[model samples]
Target: MKQLRVKVTNAVGLHARPAAVFVGEAGRFASQIRVRNATRNTPWVDAKSILSVLTLGVEPQHEIEIMADGPDDTRAAEALQQLIASDFAGKI
Candidate 1:
């Protein structure tokens, strides 16, 4: 299992578009991934699910924790961390 802590840099946070991007990326990995707001009381939610991610209420500058458990856990965690750190490439 692997875990990463990253701050969301996207201007609008993980809303619709960014959440969709994140869900797509997570789906590419053969691992179970979950996410939660690191600085809040939100419970961990399935990272690959758009609805679950959106419910997180993540906002810009919100620190989030990503956890992956499986053969590709490390890669999954790293990729997601990079994606959030880069603000989803300013796409959303």
Candidate 2:
């Protein structure tokens, strides 16, 4: 498994649109991905699933841990981290 820590920088955090964006990116890889708050006991979602991502309840400034498994884990981890860091900058 590979992991990355990303902070939600958007005012609305990972709301519907941003979460959907994240879910879309995650689907490009074959890796299994998940996101969870550092303070949480369980993961928020299956990163590839938009519905699961929206359920994360992430808020501004919240840090989330991203994890992935499979051949594309590294690339997926990088993509996920970049998404949060850039605040969906260019993509959105």
Per-residue lDDT for 1-92 in model 2, tens only? 89998788887888788888888999999999988876454565799887777777788888899999999999999988998899897676
lDDT (tens digit, per residue) of candidate 1 on 4-26: 89998778888899999999999
Worst 10 residues of 2 by lDDT: 36-45
Q: What local lDDT does model 1 show for residue 73?
A: 99
Q: Return the top candidate by lDDT.
A: 1
For candidate 2, the per-residue lDDT at 32 reads 91
Pairs of residues clashing in candidate 1: none
Given candidate 2, what's the lDDT at residue 52? 78
TM-score of 2: 0.90
